[model samples]
Target: MHTHGTETPVNAPSAEIPMTAHKTQAPTTDRSAELFEQAREVLAGGVSRNTLLRAPHPIYAERASGCRIVDVDGVERIDFANNMAALIHGHSHPAVTAAVTAQLEHGTAYTMATRAEIDYALQLRRRAPGFEKMRFMNSGTEAVMAAMKASRAYTGRHKIAKVEGTYHGGYDYAEVSQAPAPHNWGPAERPASVPLAKGTPESVLQEVVVLPYNDPEAAVAVLNEHRGEIACVVLDLMPHRLGLIPAKDAYVVALRDWTREDGALLVLDEVITFRTEVGGMQTRYGVSPDLTAMGKVIGGGLPVGALAGRAEVMEVFSAGAGGPRLPQSGTFSANPLTITAGAAAMKLYDAEAVARMNRLGTLARARIEEAIAVAGAPASVTGAGSMFRIHMKAEAPTDYRSSYPSAEEKALLSHFVDGLYDHGVMAIHTGAGALSTPMDEAVIDQLADAVLASLRKL
Candidate 1:
């Protein structure tokens, strides 16, 4: 858990504080509560996404600027969620806003492709040289689905392997075994394909092979056993639920080697991790995948997704190809507004901007670690670049099973999240945070102070 800075001794006596002692009354959100109740009549659970459900009621955002968001109740807080790490430049940057506004004047969609789409695609290809060709989609979920299908088409195999407990998207095969209970998860070396949803068909579950995170030998063994049937090995370099636990270099190399030898496509889901570098996180590891599915920051606060890869493999999507073509089309795919906004966002997030944010992230993690030592809390921080998560344990977790918090730990984390919210700082309830280009050292300091105050309250 120690960084390059001076280590703070964890010698303070453990606080004997009850969870209820720190549980203050919820924030004033009459407008939000009313809106939730009204929307529940039409919207299932009063929220579009299940993750939006929070205790008391979800805060309805009125507007946002830079790294701050104002709720319908008029409460302003420093935003770290950043729309689940998509708004790299934060809300309404002048460049992205102007681009989208100009595009709106032109038109929204059309039957033919616009020059904006071509320009945006070229911009991305230059940034990440691995993407020889790419196709835009409506979301990360759709991009993942397209990648799975392309892999099957290229390899002529039906099965896919993914790390257990890692989230790819809502798609059934990609989401299989995402959050399986301990009883259903089976052995670490040979993990079982447990369905995330109740109605997930048995046939869908059988097509996925689960692998243990960071366990190279075990992963290799499982892949070897299913060599012929596995079409691809899908992975997120930094999985969200595992506190952004980085994939080990050796483990990544092993997957690359195995997939190459077995003729299985290697799909890297960089939807969230793309913010880690201007060239994307893949460059850092020096391991390239056959297919890369990206979203989040690429859309610049807009809804968008992309699937890119070598020209040969991506040819499956081209109708002119001699063999069978994967038909891919969407009403809003590569709309001018999103393309313009995404290009502007990427332009603003150059290598210098990324390096600055990564430095801030390092400082933030160090400060949080110092606070944990001072509070004598059994916790550790895990993440790389601008993304981080505080785990409710003394040691940093390398796998999903170790990262899963106990009931008491979850309660403490909930209280911590609440305290941060009340202190004018916003973080994910799951203890994760994403830094944006709008955030500076001062914001990082403020976040560290908020964490200290929250820990003291607990």
Candidate 2:
């Protein structure tokens, strides 16, 4: 129910990606870069995921437990990225590992539904706003894709709307619609639907329409224009990728109202925002979206995703004429292992747990702000609950446009993130988001000092 008292407006999402080869910081890369070259000969890009393949070479993690990750070089650093905000309880939590181990004894996957999966869905339904039933998947991408398909089938519409700068996943539909860079994405406002990676035909991109994040007027206008053709308007509750910018209350309220008037499903993607609370960001914002996309913490450091919302919309999976007609099949969807691990993780995440983490986050942010102020750096932190991002700019952005950095600014931010590692503090290369539970006041204080020092050097 609390709103950020500050009246600062946010910027929109946008960045001019480079055509040149990705840069590297060899001096700072350490042995990780050397090992990456060996990895590249066999493993394309020396990494499994395109995002993981950073400049120079990615650090090969040898061990991770709780708040720390040890690279192959035997260097330990505090993990603020937490696997892109997935590790809500942090790495190697005893409960999660034990649950997974126990599930392994029973079986990892059976292709049939498991009791744990049903229980997990029930668990989420209990917390989600207006949640009726749910389905499971192996990743946020699958969850998002299913939601889109269900919307399309339910409404008999082919077009879908998305917020700019939101990265859903690597599926053909998702990547082409949202993922930026190397994809030859067209103009900023009205981008040409471009596939991020290979294999996605130009055909898929034609179905997606990109909209400005945190701009309700644009959304209203576009929806009016696309009315009969649009199935759903999928977007992050917060403009997370554009330096973790948050949408305004006015905009959220506006979109919710407009969607109701237009008879289109409102798909709220909470994959990253799930860390905010036990009930998810929808609970925090009090928005009852038609369908909700979920992932990250729900997997308990494993891989899982889910879609849940009002029964009227979610029932598209049930059996009946014009009733639950979409098909959602994932081999590992709702596997017992991930469900058990996820349930175990969620068990420990109560309101008190959220409070503790938020306190630590608030402490860390306050200290870092103090340091920024002292150094007089044009930097700021923004986000809600236990998640936040470090962005270097004079003002706090209101949307993606104001939030995104120029190409030079991003390079500088990446360099700064690498510098944080040099100072024994590790952050996501994107300069967005941190995790909780493994971290405490002491760890937060340590990171605050390190972040302050890093900013001072800049």
Candidate 3:
């Protein structure tokens, strides 16, 4: 196997997260605040992503290597967030950097296709049997939107069904019922299709059917109500927003059977869950989806998304046989830089690498559970493979509604996240984290230790 030669030490002394009593005090962020002030004048909301927003000001990253990130404030923290689970090998993997730098000498984007695109596609298709044919996009949202369109084109249906509170992306139909509250989220059997963005067209809402997560019977019953009108059922095997619990095998099989019977497509959004296994989380289900939307770690920390699945379904994007039903093309689609970096990163994440990372995930989750018990905190952990989430509830939540945080729980979680930040650990604000290939048991222990300290303080 090839190696990322002479890589920077991931376990350097600087990577150690301080567990000092000073954790209660806020770190100095004068420089970050200054940058935010300047950013406010130009960048809306003082940041490019709403996810980057913090209470005072978002900390500005100076540089990152391996599992550690240094901020403009001269503070170094362990980066468990990993760019929202997009950095499988962690920031600036030597191989990815070297490959991308080499690609830069050749060129960047081009109107013509490169061998890099074909090579990367081949690599991905080999990894996941379900990815028979694929087309690249710029982000997960675009891939999902394209997949939904392909489903409609192939099935000749008008509506799409998705699990409630499962975040696919920013597309209009995709975002429906992503975060409906108790009052708005109607009956459990058939969830109401609530709009995420303000003034999302009623027509878009009408075309989306929301199904309850995990409960296979209820979900299938809802799909049955829709009958042949549904084009696809969008799913995230383990939705992070829904508390990072893997979907029950029964639920997946139910969707697979339902879609097969209804002549609708099963679109698995593995953009996040793809890291869970060499062939993605779907491989464990003993079934295959008609379409799969992939992104995140596949980009090698850059921007990329891909729609891959049965060639029959993906043929909707083809233009050769006849005028394509869904013409898909982007200026930056399959650009050389992303393709080269992704290929480098993925090549390094072999089956052994995946197993090691997942073992670290299991260790991290176990340690966090031990910490919860030691602190006597009413918290539970749920996750599979290389990711985990800490819930404030006494038991791990079974579904979105069950996991939905109450006002007190939400406030506590916010404070807990701030506490984790103060303790030199950066996790997704939801108390969730995805392990990177660069991490080991030592790093997992430090992360769990931070969780313990934060929970004790609370």
Score candidate 3 by lDDT: 0.87
The reply for model 3, stretches above 4 Å from the true place, is: 1-29
* Whole-model lDDT values for every prediction: 0.86, 0.74, 0.87
lDDT over C-alpha atoms for residue 296 of model 2: 85
Per-residue lDDT of model 3, residues 1-458, tens digit only: 11112323332223433322323355654799999999999998898899888878888998887788878767777889999999998877777888999999999999999988999999999988888999988899999999999999998998999999999999999999999999999998888999999999999999999998889998888898889899999999999998898988899999999999999999999999999889898887766999999999899888999999999999898886678999878999999999998889888888888877887788788889988999899999999998999999998899999999999999888888887887889999899998887776667777877898999889
> Which candidate do you rate higher for lDDT, 1 or 3?
3
Which of the numbered candidates is closest to the native, going by highest lDDT? Answer: 3
Question: Any residue pairs clashing in model 1, and if so which?
Answer: none
Superposition-based RMSD of candidate 2 using all C-alpha atoms, in angstroms: 8.2
Write one digit per residue (lDDT tens) for candidate 1, span 232-347.
99989999975689999999999999999999999999999999988788999988899999999999889999999999999998777464568879999998878888998898
lDDT tens string, model 2, 1-458? 11232311111012211122212223344678778878889987677876676676688887777777777766777789899888877777776777889889988899576777777777777776577878888899888889899998888888887776677876566665454653454455565565666767766777877776666776677667777787888868764675576677777888888777877788988898877767887787888889988988888888999888888787788888754488667788888888898898887887777776767667667777776787788888887777778887778776555666778777778777877887777888777657557676667666776777777777
lDDT of 2 at 52: 78
- Order of candidates by TM-score, top first? 3, 1, 2
Off by over 4 Å in 1: 1-29, 321-324
The window of 10 residues in a row where model 2 has the poorest summed lDDT is 7-16
Compared to the true structure, candidate 3 yields what TM-score? 0.94
Tell me the lDDT of model 1 at 62. 79
